[model samples]
Every structure is written in C-alpha cells, then in structure tokens.
Target: MFDDRASVATAAGMRLAQAGVRWDVVKVRRFLGLQAIEHIEQPGAVAVDPHSPEPMLYFFVPAGTLADWDVPDTRALNSTECTTHVVLPPGHREAPPGPYWLLPPSCGLTPTDTLHRALERALHRPDPHPHFRIDTAAMRADAAQLIGDAAELPESTVLPQLVQRLRGHLMVLVPHVEDRMRAFARTAETRLVAQVTVGEAQRRLNSVPGLTFISEIKHAQTLARSVEALCRHAEVPTHTVAKAPAPTVGVVQQ
Candidate 1:
C-alpha cells in the first residue's frame, strides 16, 4: 500500500501516482481551467499539458470525490470506474514538452464547490454567445486602442496602418457574429428580423476604428459597400487605406 507521500518512480524522470489512493483529478480545458484559476483564491497542484492536441489542466481534488461531475467542459477523474495513474513531474519544478505545474501541489486540494461555481460562472455569466470562444473583450480593447491611435496621430501619419490592423481583426469576427445573428433572426419575431440586418451593418461600420466615419462620412452607402467588400475578401490580400475608398472623408488620405 502506497502512503500519502509515496510515488512510483518511472524511467522517464517522472512519477506515477495511483488515483483514488491519494487524490482525484478534475480535468478541464485550458481556457475554462484558467477561468477556474481566476475564481479560486489558492488552487492546488494544477498540471497543464500544453503540447497536447487539446491542452488540458488537471486539478487535484480529494480522492473518491467529484466522480460524477455536473460541470460542463470538465471531467472528474477518480478510481471509481477503473484503475488510473496520474503522471507527475519528477520534482517540484516544471518540465517543458510534457506536463507542467500551473499551480504546484499545496497542503490542500481545490474545493469542488468553488470549482463548480467558477466553471458555472465562466460558462453562463460572460457574453451573449457563451458556447463560442469569441474573445470580445480583447476585440473591444483593440477597438479602443485604434480609437486612441486615430485621436493622437494625424490620418496621414500611422492611422492607416492602425486602422488596417483593427480592420483585419474585425473581419475575422464579423462572419461568426453574422451567422449567429442570422440564426437568431430565423427564430425571432418579424420586427426583430429587420433589426438584425440593420444592426449588423451598423456594427460593421461602427467597428471601423475611429468614430469619424459614422459622424462625417456623407456617402454611407458607398462606405458600406467598401466594408462589405472587405468582409467578403477577408481571406485574400489585405487592402490598404489607399486602395480602400473612404467616401466623402479623406480619412485614408491616399
């Protein structure tokens, strides 16, 4: 019988510990795992396999616990079903190209209640599309940065390049958002249907870096056409401000 401190040494300079003998593991995706880490104060022995096809984090919990986990995108690994071995680092430090510790083992394991609540919040309390991993917060930050850049510098200086960068990021986001809106339109009320189309156009236009386009551009239709063209050719070569026309406003200047 293995004691709490006992571990079977392997030839690969790693150790294998039998699950349910000492502790159970809560396996989760890296994103959700990060979320869980954010929710908890001090987590225990969180191991991450960054090289895996889908990187996973393993959270050590009390043995014979959380086997029938109800949390989404998480798996509770215990020895209830079968014998399991947990690959542990040889020492108290991280080794790359293999499992490394995000949070090394402490005197305690992660509380299941805290972990479950964290996963629940991470799942339901974020943006509208909870299922999709659209980092809208990062996108909004980029948009804000673009606004600041446009305000600080002349349009001819470096504003064009800033706009292009923001535009590329927005292009990647637009299609995913459009598809979600369309799906909503089909099931939503008739009055809501037109709102989707209008909102879609407005959002695309509004996402065009500075607020000047919405305020000063007289030829809205032409600008809309340009934005649409960019959306359609998102995968193709990127068009500079000189090539992309900004109607009635010399924002591009070229």
Candidate 2:
C-alpha cells in the first residue's frame, strides 16, 4: 500500500507498469526531501519513479547524476509543499509540451513552464461541472462554529441529560444519509495507490445522489436545529405562548 512512505515509489511503479507507461512525474521538494537531506543542494541528483503520472512535475537537480541517487527524500510535507518545487526528471527525453518545464523558472526569468501556461488557460478554462460548484470552505466554517458553540456547555449539565435532549432532535434529520457516502466505498472497479487532488474528490462526490446544494442546505439546517436544541438544554427555558386574539364583531354575524 502506498500509504506507507517506503512503498509509494514501488507501488507507483507497479501501477505505471500495469498501464504500460514508462514515466510519471514527481514534485522537486518531495523528491529531494525523501532523500533525508537536511537541506537540498542547488543541484543534486534525485531518484524518480518514472512511472508516476502525467500532470505531475517530475523534479531532479541538474548538478548530479544517477550515481548521486544514494538517498531518497523521506521528509514529510505540509506548509512547505506549495513553496518548494515542481521540476523535470533527469535524463528524461520526451518532456511534456511547452507548459511542461525541465527546470522551474528561478528569479526574474519569464515564465515558460506548463504550470504558468495552465494557469493562463485556467482563466479561460470552461466550467466542467457548473451546477456542482460548491463553497466547501464556507460549509466547513459553519460546522466549526457549530462545534465551537457546543463545546461551551456549562459544566453542571450532566452528560446523560445532554445526550437525551440531543437524541430526539437528531431524529428530525435523516440518519440513513443516502447514496453519496455509498459511492465512496463502492467506486473501486479499478483501483490504484495514487495521489488524488481535492478537486477530483469533489468532482467525484458531486456525482453521488442526494449531494445537490439544496439537499446539503436542508441537511445543514436540520443539523443546526439539533445542535441548537442541545444548547438550549443547558438553560431549560419555558416557551411563552402568545395570547389568543380577542373575538371580533364578526362573531355576531356568525
């Protein structure tokens, strides 16, 4: 399983072999980081799994040869990913089109890489799935606010009582949330250990049933009601009834 760092290259290679492809791309920093380097040299040799994947920027240093491939970049990445690199594999002949770059531009050189060209295209790129475009960031923000409020319950409230109140309100929403989740589990007709971008995950998830915006909004509203009910449990306030309207003169006509 490529889930293990050590297995990623071999797993990637096997996947490529299955497809009869000889090359796959790698990110430069990652290629170097995996080598356990405390810091990367300006030009250093990097071992690459050519069988990686297209749309991947294969990174290799120009200063080194295959002989320098004594180490693998094993460092993990997070905040550093976007800042580090995107490069070309050493000794690789048929590099991808103009948008593709053997060397990522440094300093003030005019942008000639595929990434730059692709971003230029993106400005004009047509919407592939217009209807499914969603604001997941906003959705996540709302969820964070809900949980943040929930975490503020008074210490005096017993956990059991909290659970009892929340349960009835939870029943208001459909607990057997439908086909959207099922797709994630069953979409394995052909599987490979590969990197998938969040955009791709959303694109696939959008295809599932009960995943439309209106459906999501309804679900969110139901969840909000349940959470509000839990919060109200802490105060146990009484609901004041509005007085009935006085009978009007029309009663005489009746």
Candidate 3:
C-alpha cells in the first residue's frame, strides 16, 4: 500500500512537471506494526506493522502549481487515498492547510506569513544592531582620503567622473546596509518585519558613528504602527518606543 501510494505521488509529480508545473516533493510515510495493532482503533492515527516492511503514504501539494493549470474543484483519487487540493495564485485567498507534500513551480515553499513572522521575531531580538554595521565616519574619512589622494595623481587620462561615481557608490552602499539589516531582522523569529525610516533628527545624526538615517521618520513610525496592528490581530503585546531625552548646553565659568 505504501509503495503504491509513493508511486502514485511520484507519478502525479511527474505529470505536473511534464505539464510545465514546477514543484518540490515532500514525502509522508506511515507504518503499521505490533504497536500499531495494539492501538489500531485510534482516529487519524496510522499504525506501523514492524514485521511488514510496507506501510501507507499520505501527502498534500501546495496550491500555487495549479494557478496556471485548469484544476477541477472535486477531490481526486490517488492509488491509496483521496486527495483534497486547491489552487491559489499569488495574492489570492489565504494559503490552504498542508504538510504540503508538493511544492508547485514558481512557488517557493516559504509562506508569506511565515516569512513575515520570522522577520518580526528576528527584529525583536534584544540586540538592535544590524548584522552588518558600518562606521559612517570611517567610511567618509576613507572616501575623502581616496579622493584627495586621487586629486594628486597626474590625470591618468580622463578620470571616470570621480565625485559623481563616488556619490553613486555611497548611494549603493545605503541600500546594501538596508538589505543587510532587513536580512538580519528576518532571521530573528518567524514573526518580525522591518522597514527603514529616516527622520530630520536621524538625517542630522547621520554623521553619528552607528546610526542609520534613511528617508523619513514617518516610515519608521508607520512600520511601528503596522507591527502594533499585527500584534493586536495576533493577541500579542504592542511594543513601545522610548522617547529621546532633551539635550542641554553648559556655559563655561570664568
């Protein structure tokens, strides 16, 4: 029975592949043995027979593969079991349940919610530092030194627009930093999300050693709000951000 089920699943996967549907195979196996015989009456539980090498196989396939194919709504029969399947294209209804034994073409196994949750968890870790950290002062100093050194070099033919190129390089670095941060954040837990936000204060503080200043404070605020909303939806606590302290200047005494 198990071998037949495995064969059927393999055949189904091959059919999908031949039809130009890309997918990954995940296998689920059941065994019936002496112990299984003792508890064979349990519902939804399969018993494996130790003496018999063969067992039963049951599985599910992700719905995305059928997005392009015409799939009937009715359940289909496999060699050993009836299979319940649904087709869900990107941005369609919520994902269906599964130990989804099959992963369809163009449909990576990672679910959107699962990814979001993982990112959220990663971001909420006690450490706020991004995985990759850059010293802005050091970078700027290096850039200035490089440019100054280049200025002294005899014009080795036409210099590729130095300043413009340097500026572009910095622009590229900004996104790289953000990408690293996001990636680090995603690895936290299966529930975190992160968005970079730039604020006037953040902009002014860009020169600060480890601070990150992106586009606007509003964006970060919006992300925080979104996180809060998600927490509410999940019946989780909303995190609060602490306000910065006011700064004061001291006068020199004669």
Top candidate (TM-score): 1
TM-score of each: 0.49, 0.18, 0.18
lDDT for model 3, please.
0.27
lDDT of 2 by residue, 1-254 (tens): 01112121222122111100111122433222222222222322223332345222233322112222222322212222232222222222212222222222221111113322332333343431222222233333343333544543323334222332222222211111111112222222111111122223223222222445445333333444444433322222122323334446654211
- Tell me the whole-model lDDT of each prediction, alpha carbons only: 0.55, 0.26, 0.27
In lDDT terms, how accurate is model 1? Answer: 0.55
Task: Give me the runs in candidate 3 sitting further than 4 Å from their true place.
Answer: 1-129, 134-142, 145-158, 173-243, 246-254
Q: Weakest 10 consecutive residues, lDDT, candidate 1?
A: 235-244
Comparing 2 with 3 on TM-score, the higher-scoring candidate is 2
Q: Which pairs clash in the backbone of model 1? A: none
Q: Return the TM-score for candidate 1, rounded to 2 decimals.
A: 0.49
Q: Write the per-residue lDDT of candidate 1 for residues 1-254, one digit (tens) a residue.
A: 11337578876677888777778888888766765565677666677675678778888887767767888778878788888787876454443446766555643688777778878887775452424454455444444443433423334444443443343344334454454444332333421433444456446544323346544222233233434433333222212212322335433221
Worst 10 residues of 3 by lDDT: 93-102
- Per-residue lDDT, model 2, residue 227, is 42
